[model samples]
Structures are given as structure tokens and as C-alpha cells.
Target: MPGCCLWGSAPPAPSGERKGAGWLELLLLLLLILSGWVLTQQPVGCPRVCECFVEEKTVKCANQNLTEVPPDLPRDVQNLFLTGNRLRDLSSGAFPSEPLLELRNLSLRGNQLEQVGAEAFARLPNLKQLDLSQSALLWVSPMAFGNASSPLEELRLSNSLYNYSVVAAIAELLQRGIFQNLKHLDLSSNGLVSLPPGIFSRLPSLQHLDLHNNSLVSLRDVSFGALHQLQRFDLGDNALKRLRNDTLAQLRGLPWLTRLDLGRNAWVCDCGIEDLARWLKESDQVEAKEALKCSEPEEKQNSSLVSLPISGLECLEPDDDQTQLQTSYVFLGIVLALIGAIFLLVLYLNRKGIKKWMYNIRDACRDHMEGYHYRYEINADPRLTHLSSNSDV
Candidate 1:
């Protein structure tokens, strides 16, 4: 009976055991409180000027008037925005003192960056996207990035690269096989007059190229020859008067091309632009098809390029120089024909004399051969020589 407990009836425990149980429960509660506090606290290592989101792993220092990159930043940040700053130069080790191994995207747009030093982004090994648009970037070292086989896929240099020299430098860098994994590139509003040949040859994976709002008068066929994966190309708002058939053929050769922008250009509706106008009519890839209008030749100033028929785009009457050249060619050809006819007529009129002269030459050759033959026989035999001499006497 003493060892057995009845229903809803139990024996009391010792005070020491009770106290031990209470202490254990208190310890568990304290531990939970501490863990909750740790979870709620803000992440450390955030720079004073930056707003860092711990959960998203993003750091935004945009429009902060920062002269340099913040020295203290979370080591695991993936996206960093440093736009609208006064960062004039980006030297090597441009990031924080310690490398951000997890960084994937970096933006330096709207900065006053004049130069980018060698291996400036060497620390960010996993970087995939970079934005340097709206900056005054005058120079970028060929080795600004450490790896030629970098994983960077998107690069924006719009509104930068003011002169041909800067563009040439960038072209040289691309030709060196840097950023081989690049996909999207923005070079719009760069005041480019012409792109260097084979400029995009090394970028085999490029899918989107934006070159709108430039001063490009013409494009070489080889400029986009290697962009087999290109899907979108923007050549709008340029100073182009006409596109050559070879250039249009090159555009058509892009297997993946889906969107093309050629509007807002100074198109001239003439024989020189027949190829482009015909291409516009036949192809549906051109964006803003209705806005492409002719700007020259008072009669076609406001005409749409897409609506103009190939027959309507006629060559103007031959200029004086062209007429003169054509006349000279015709005269030369006639003179040659007349000379040939005269020569034939002269040969016919002198046929008899020519035949007699030919017979005289043949007889002289025959007699001379016979004399040589007789001399050889006389030399070979002494009897023959004496006999011939006696006969002669």
C-alpha cells in the first residue's frame, strides 16, 4: 500500500530535487532569451555611410557623396551600389581591406571616375555584373580585371567613353579575351563615330548590344560578324545616312537576332539606301518600324523608310563627272573595235603581196639549207671535195 500511489494522490519530493528542477528550467529560459536577442540584433561590420540589409546581403551607399569605398563592409555582401559618388579613380584593391568573396554585383554609376587601375576587381572572383554608366571614365587599364575567363555577364558603360581613344582601349581589352562570359553590353550615348573592326570578335556569348544615340555614320560588316548569339541590337538615334547591302547581310546573319533598332537616324531615301529600305520592308525585327523616315532630298524628307518601295528609290540623273566617265568608256571601246576592223581590212587588201613575200622567204631559206648540206658532205670525204673542185674547174 505504501509503495503504490492512488489515483490523483502522490507523495511530496525533497526540497533539493525541487530546487534543482527549478534551476534547470530557469537556465533553459535564459538560453532561449539570449538566442532571441542575438537573432534580433543588427549585423556588425556595416560602414557608417552605407545601409546594409543582413537578410538580403545588399549594401547601398548610393548618392552618399562618398569620395572612396567604405573601408568597413560586411564580408558576405553580394550586391553593392555606390552610385552618385565622387570616386574619381579606382586603384587596385578597390574594395574593402578584405575581399568580399561573396560579391556578385557592383555598381559605380554616376561617379566621376577618370581611371581604373590594373586588376581593380581582382578580389571579387565571383562577380557577375558591373555598372559604370554615366561616369566620366577616360581610361581603363587592360588588366582592370584579373581573369580573362571572368564570369562577368553584364557590363554597362553607357554615357561614358567620350572619345575614340577610350573606345579603342576598351576594344583592345576585349580583344585580349577578357570577360569571355559576357552576355549583355551597353555602350549607348558614347558619341561613337565608328567601331573598330572585330571589336566584338572575342565575345562569343554576347546576347544583347546597345549602341543607340551615337554618331555612327556607318558600320563595318565585320563589326558584328562574330555575334552569333546576339538577340538585340540598338543602332537608333545615329547619324547614319544609309546602310550598305553587305552590312544588312551581316545583320541578317545573326542567327539569334530578334530585336533591331534603327530608328531616328538621318536616312536618305535614294539608291544608296535602297538596301536598307528593302530590308526594313522585308524584315520584322526592326523596332519602331514606323518612325524610320528619310531626312534628306527635299521630296523625301518626311517619307517613311519602311513604306517606300524599292522601285521608288531611284538614282538621281547622272552627274557631270559620271556622264563624262561613261562617255569616255564608250569612246574607248568604239576606238578599239574600229582599230581591229581597219587592221583586218588592210590585211585583205595586201593579200597577194603578202603571199609573194612569204614564197621569197621560203626559197631563200631552202637554198641556204642546201649550201650547208653540200659543205658538210665535202668536209666528211676528201674524194668528194676533190671531185667537186674538178667539176667546178
Candidate 2:
């Protein structure tokens, strides 16, 4: 068979300077290739200072002397490290305004963050771990971490501003169950004096709590009542003088609690401290118990609070009623002895005068008795003579 001529007759092409037209087509194809190459060389919207790893979905922009969050980060970044920067404030949409659906870990440690707005991290829906440690964080809006789409597991706010208002705002969130799924929370070195009652009750999944290096003077029984899953509790380096029985008893309910740090506190080894000492002696989970020294009561100052026996702890001042009763008895005995001594002294000083007055009274009585007897005898003579004559007749 004659080869089937599929291309019987092709349409005639437009006539031009045929050689020049071929050259123009070649030039256009070269330009297109060069443009494609240039576009590939530069990733679209990648921040200049940030180093993005596409395969790992990570952005490492740490310690680059950045004044603010780098703009136009890849939307798919999962881990972002912004540590050691000059990020002063986190206003609304301060970071990349684009939604980051895969972002999980965000670190802002060692920054100068003075304020954090309510929606600062609203674009990150899947954020799980956040580190704001070592920042000069002075203000945090109550809704700063609100509206998170994912369950935040870890939050580190350590060594931030020691502001009560900031802590109270966090407390408000805790009370409202905003961090119910939080597992690890670091609130150390915040100069907190006392935690709000039931502040940690809503976080049922919390495992580790760091409250060390604060000025916490005491804790309420309800302050940690609902933390059943707590494994580690740190109360070290605080200004706690003693813990109440209810406060210590509340800890007994946490079956999973394994480690407790109560060292480096201002413990007072007094009668009121027996419960704490007994608790320490009974529980083996307390770490550094021997280092829990006393900071009050000159007699027990600097002594190991945990080692002191419950019987050895005594009140500096005895019971008021007992003391008053003993004092009254001593005072009464002294007064009675003083009265008796005075009576004896008076008798000894007036002994001669008393004797002379008794003698004079005796002499006058004797003379009056003799005179009465003589008068009676003279009156009776006539009757006696009459009686004798009558008997003789």
C-alpha cells in the first residue's frame, strides 16, 4: 500500500522576512526561559531575613536583630522561631496577616515584648506550643490567647513582668476554662503573692505547674483543688512561712502528683508548722525536704523544718488563759503572804502596850470583887443572929 499520505497538502504559511521571523521566534523562546529561571531563583513572598525550610515547614528567623515580626512569611510554616529579637509590641495582626493553618510551635523568647493584643496570634489556628519566656511583657489583654482554634498544650510566660493585673487577667482565663487543655504551664518569677481561689480548677488536663521564685505567701485550699492530673508542682524560692492544713490536704487528692518542690522558702518552725512538717515526713514525693529551713523564731531559726518533731514545735507564747491563771495564782499568794507579814509586824511592835492594858484591867476587877464581898457580910449578920436564937429556943 502506498504510505497513506495523511498530510495531503498543508496550508501555505504567511509570507514574511522568513529568516528574520525564525530569529524573532528564537529570541522570544529564550526570553521566556530566562524569565522562568529568574522566577524559580526567588521564592514568592519569602521574608529576606528568614530562612525557610520548605520540606520541614520551618522558619528560623531567630537572633537576627529584628525590630518586629518579619513580614510575608510562608503561609505553610509549621514552626516559627522568633527568639532574641526586639519585638516590642504584638498588636492586632502584627505578624503575617495571612492565615497560617499549619503553624504549631511559636517561640518569642528573649524579646522586648511590652504588650500583646487580644488577636495578636489569631492568624495561627493550629498553634499548640507558645514560648513567651524572658520577655519584658508588661501587658497582656485578657483575650490575648482567646479564640484559638486548636488546643494549646504548652504555654510559657516565665520571667515576664511582675504585674498583678497581668496575672489576674490570666487568672480570669483559668477561671473561665480557657486553658482547659493546657498540659504544661510556667508562671514562675512573676512576683505573685497569692493565687485566686479555684484559679487552676478548670484546667483538668494540666500536668505540670511552675510557681517557683514568686512572692507567694500562702495558698488557699481551693486554689489547686481541681488539678487531679497534676504531676509536678514547684513552690520553691517563695516567701511562704507556713502552709495551712487544708492547703496541704488538698494536695493529697491529686493521685498523679509525683514531684513537689517546697525548698528555698521562708519556713517558720513553730507550732503552726507541725502540719507541714508532718505532711513532709509522711509524703516521700517532696523534693529537697531537708533543705526546707526555718526563717523565723530565733530558737528554731535556720533549723530544718521537716526534721523538727511535731512535739518539739511549741508556741513562743503560752495559751493566754493558762498564762493568765498562773499569773493570778502567783499574784494572790504574794498578796496573802504580804498581809500575814504585816499583821505579825504590827503585833510585835505593840506587844508591851497590849500587856500593860491587860494588867490594869485585872487590878480594877480584883478591888471591885473584895468590896462587894464586905458589904454582903455586914448585911447578913442580923439574919444570922436571928436564925441562931430561934434554933436555941
Candidate 3:
């Protein structure tokens, strides 16, 4: 009878029924299917246009005609090669800054970049090397790279279309020590006429400096005061006439300096150049000593600066004794000329009196001659006087 009652109870509903479990399973199955579909729709890492080496963490996007940074770059990219791109300007957030935190090397060379925003590289904390060369850059904001979290080691802004305005802003940045950790800096081929005083004072760690192919007129003694660790200095192909002895002294302050390129410049080879010549000969710092030439003093023209003796290079001082003597002679001659002119003027003004005095002298001389003649005639009349005495007797 008990078995009969259990059968009527529908076998206890087969014992394992949980009412909500089917719906829960169905929901989980739908969620998993949805996740799989999403995963399949997403492409693999790296943008379609870029070739990324995930293992090496390097991205080669060079010459990609990329107008803007791709949005789908891997987050682990360290070296980014965006050279020869059509990137006009580096505005803030142009590239996803968060994804580029690990980026170390950035190459923007050959790009048509004219301006760079201040917050352009603010998000790249580990960035060390940057190449903005050949960018046709006309202006750079003074606040560019301001408060940068990166320790930029190498910077190349050379061959950019930097006029005085851009160069001045750059000088201001250098003077303020914006890139203090920079070791190698290339500012060559910039149309720089002159550098601001104490421009390199803040770059204490700078080891190599390139100022070649510029229109630099001079370098001051205090210009490299803070570059105590400088090893190489390139002033070749510049418009430099001469370097001051004091400036040479400042260059000497760098004990580690090994290579100096002073060739292809307009060297005067005068007294002011003696110190540099001596340095070129004696010091082992000059790298291209043989290539150095003098452009001035027709005699020293094209002569090798290194071989020229220091004694041969003598500058004529503007205030030297010889100059002073010449000046004094000129002054004396002028004074004599003035005196002679005054005398002539006086003679001309008193022409009538002078003429009357000359006439009076002529008359007096004539009267004296006539008197002499009359005396001679009287002496000759002595015989007549004797005849007259006889008649009186």
C-alpha cells in the first residue's frame, strides 16, 4: 500500500528539480556565446596599418602616410618609428598618452610638424630619446615639454626652419634648464646667428653639443660654464670669425673634452684667434685640426689654422701704440694745416696793408740807392772845391 501511494505522488517528481536552475543555465550559456562572439569580432593586437613586433615591443610605422596616430596600437610598445609621416603638429592627446607610457624612443623626423603643444609628451613618462629633425618647425611653444615626467636624454631639433623667434624660445628653454638631463643635443643646420649668453649654463650633464652649419658669430666664456662633462663640441661650417681666449678658457674647463670640430668656419686667424690656434696645436681636443682654414687676412687666406704659428697671427689693435702714433701724426698734420690756413686767411684779410708796407720798403730802398749815388758824385767834386778856395784867396 505504501508503494501504491508513492506511485500516485508522481514518483516524488524525479527528486532533482530546482525551478530556477534551467533559466540560470540558459542565461550563462547566452552570456558565454555573447562573449565568444565579441572576442571573435575583435582583431588581434596592433593596428592594421602598422607592423608591430609584440615580442620586441617595437612598432615600425615609418613612411606610413599617417596623418594621425593610430588608435589601435599595442599598449606595450617601447620604440615607435613614425618618421616620414605627414604629421603637421603634435597636439595634446593626438596619441593615446596612457598607452604610450612605456615608449622610450620616438622618431618624428622628416615630418612636416610646425608646432608642438606643451602637453604633447607629458604622458610619456619613460621617454628618453626624441628626434624632431627635418620637421620644418617654425615655432615651438616655450611651454612645450614643460613639466615633462620623462628624463629626455637625447634631443635633435636640427635642420628645422628655426628663425630668431624659434631659436630665442629654444634658448629660453635651455637657459631655464628645461632639459637638464640631456646628454646629446644637435642644433646644427639651424639659421642661428648668435646664441644668448649663458645658454648652456643649465645643461650640466650635456656631453656632446652640435652647433655646426649655423651662422654663429661668437661663443662666450660663460656659454659653456655648466657643461663640465662636455666631451665633444662641433662648431664646424659656421660663420664664426674667431673664438675669444676667455671662451677658449671656458672650453678648457671641460677636462673630459676629447673631440672639437672647428673646421669649415670663417676664421680671421688674427690675435683673437691665437688662443684657438694654440689650443688646436697643443691640446688633443680638436678633432679636425687639419681641416681648419683662415678666411681673412689675404695672406693667411686658405692657410691651415693648425699649422699656422701663434706668432704669425697678430691682431692689429685699434688702440695700439702704432695706431696712437698714426692718430697723433694725423692730428698734428691737421693742426699744422689749420694754422697755415689761419695765416693765409690773415694775409688775405690784410692784403691792402701788406701791399702798402711792401710799397714803402721799395721806396725806402730806392731813396737809399739814390743817396749813395749823390755821395759818390760829391766825393768826385773834390778838385772843383780846390779851384773855388784859390778864387777866395
TM-scores for every candidate against the unseen true structure: 0.69, 0.67, 0.67
User: Candidate 3 lDDT, tens digit per residue, 195-245?
Assistant: 766778788889999999998766643467788889999988888777777
* Cα-based lDDT for every prediction: 0.85, 0.81, 0.79
Enumerate clash totals for all models, in the order shown: 0, 0, 0
Name the regions of candidate 1 deviating beyond 4 angstroms: 1-41, 316-393
lDDT of 2 by residue, 32-75 (tens): 99999877755676688987777788888889999888878888
Q: Which candidate is the best by TM-score?
A: 1
User: What's the CA error at residue 159 for candidate 3, in Å?
Assistant: 0.7
What TM-score would you give candidate 2 relative to the actual structure? 0.67
Weakest ten-residue segment in model 3 by summed lDDT: 384-393
Top candidate (lDDT): 1
C-alpha positional error of residue 217 in candidate 2 after TM-score superposition, expressed in Å: 1.3
Compare candidates 1 and 2 on lDDT and give the better one. 1
- Using TM-score as the yardstick, the better of models 1 and 3 is 1
Candidate 1 lDDT by residue in tens digits, 234-350: 989898888888788988899899899888888777777778888888887788888888897889898988888788566753422135457889999999999999999999999
Clashing pairs in 2: none
Clash-forming residue pairs, model 3: none
Rate residue 98 of model 1 by lDDT.
Answer: 73
